[model samples]
Target: MVRITNTIDIDASTQQVYAALRALDAYPTWLRHSTVYRGTKMRTPQSGKSLSYEDSTMVGRMRGEVVEDVPDHALQFHQRKPSGSLDALIRYEVSAAGTGTHLTRVGELTTHGMLHIVQPILLRMAAAESERTMKSLKAHVEGHPI
Candidate 1:
């Protein structure tokens, strides 16, 4: 198991940040390695909803379920590979920071089979990608290009 956590302060209100997080369709624009959903479109973040999508950095198409959803507060997703070789949980928490919003992202990944041999490298990559994504999210919310 590996865990990666990142936090970023967005120069926007909590509502604005939350709205942006819920906009799954725009993920490919700022999120590194993200791709469009293939099965069903995610209109909004709601508990029990499932999304099937593919990411460039992932092994294959992944299916994720919304485990928890609190508007303007927190959102959590649990994803797993189709073959059950990999599983991950991603969580986003938002809070008021001065006049802006403080967003924290936490990711945990577990691997099986041959993936265990390179777990350390995968964890490092996840951390780096997460940092990049944070910068992009901040830039996007602040109306600038990353």
Candidate 2:
């Protein structure tokens, strides 16, 4: 398994940051991945709620569920292959920082199956991607266009 954690301070209130992070519909505006939905219905994030999503990323298309959504505090999701291989776990933690908001993201990737062969390379890529994503989140919450 590979784990990567990144933290960023955004110039916004925790409430503002939390709201923006929960706005799944606005992901494409800041997130590099183009999200595609498998189901027509969309719901807000909440504990035990699962949302299916397909996102185009550097590693290609990934399908995942956004689970364990703790309002204003944390969000977590698990990505798995159609064959049932656990690919990754992405988590977000938010808190008040001074007069702004502090966001921390943790990404854990399982090195099972064929992924073990390229684990090192994949780990580096995941770290870089996490940094990029945090920067994008900062920009998005600071009223800047990503």
Candidate 3:
């Protein structure tokens, strides 16, 4: 298993940050190299219902499910191929910091079958991607040029 975490400061309110994170359509707007993110299923915000999205990236594409969402606080999910072989558990968190928000994203990837052969490389790539996305998200959500 490989795990990584990234954090960025957003000059926005917690609510605003949460809203951006909750909107599936806005993911690709901030996340670089993310070409697709369509919410096929979603639960009400109050119920903190699970949501599923299909994402396409330069490397490949996969389906991801939101497993946890705490308003103004955090969002967590598990991502995998449609075959359900490799898995990526991800979490996003927000905190009120002074007058802004501190956003954090954490992810763990586990491989099955022969995918383990490239686990190290994949982990490194994921870490780099996570950092890049967080920085872009911070700029985009904070109303800065991205």
Candidate 4:
């Protein structure tokens, strides 16, 4: 099993941070490795409904389901991949920090089947990707013109 987590501070309010994070349409503007996104389902901010996004990554395009959500606080999901040892769980958390917001993103992978042998490599890759995603998100949220 591989677990990767990254946290960053954004000079934005929790609402602003959460809005940017939860919107699938905003992902391409923030998530660097998510070069392509399609088949997105989302709900209004007040609804607290479910949303899903199909993201294209270096590993391949995968469908992720929003399994957990807590308004401006957190979001968690699992990525479904077929015929691979990769089972992925991704989570994002946001909280107010002074005049800004603290954001954390974690991606965990469990390897099985024939992919067990490469668990280490896969874990490292997940770490790098998770970090990159956080950096991009931070840049997007903090860089917004006031």
lDDT of each: 0.77, 0.74, 0.76, 0.73
Once fitted onto the true fold, the runs of candidate 1 whose alpha carbons sit more than 4 angstroms away are: 32-56
Ranking of candidates on lDDT, top first: 1, 3, 2, 4
Q: After superposition, how far is residue 140 of candidate 4 from its true place, in Å?
A: 0.5
Give the range where candidate 2 is weakest over 10 consecutive residues by summed lDDT: 34-43
What is the per-residue lDDT of model 2 for residues 68-95, given as tens digits with 9 covering 90 to 100? 7888898887776565434889999999
Candidate 4: Cα lDDT at 87: 77
Error of 4 at 82 (Å): 2.4
Candidate 2's error at 2, in angstroms?
1.3
> Which structure is stronger by TM-score: 1 or 4?
1
Query: Which residues of candidate 3, in runs, are more than 4 Å off?
Result: 34-49
Per-residue lDDT over 61-144 for candidate 4, one digit per residue giving the tens place of the 0 to 100 score: 566778888989998988865656467888889999999999888788887876688777767766766776677777788784
Prediction 3 global C-alpha lDDT: 0.76
Which regions of candidate 4 are displaced past 4 Å? 33-49, 144-146
Q: Tens digits of per-residue lDDT for model 1 on 1-146?
A: 78899999999999989888777667777665543222323434456545433443456566676677799999887877778887889899999999999999999999998878878877877787778878888998899986
**Residue 21 CA displacement from its true place in model 4, Å:** 1.2
Worst-scoring 10-residue span by lDDT in model 1: 34-43
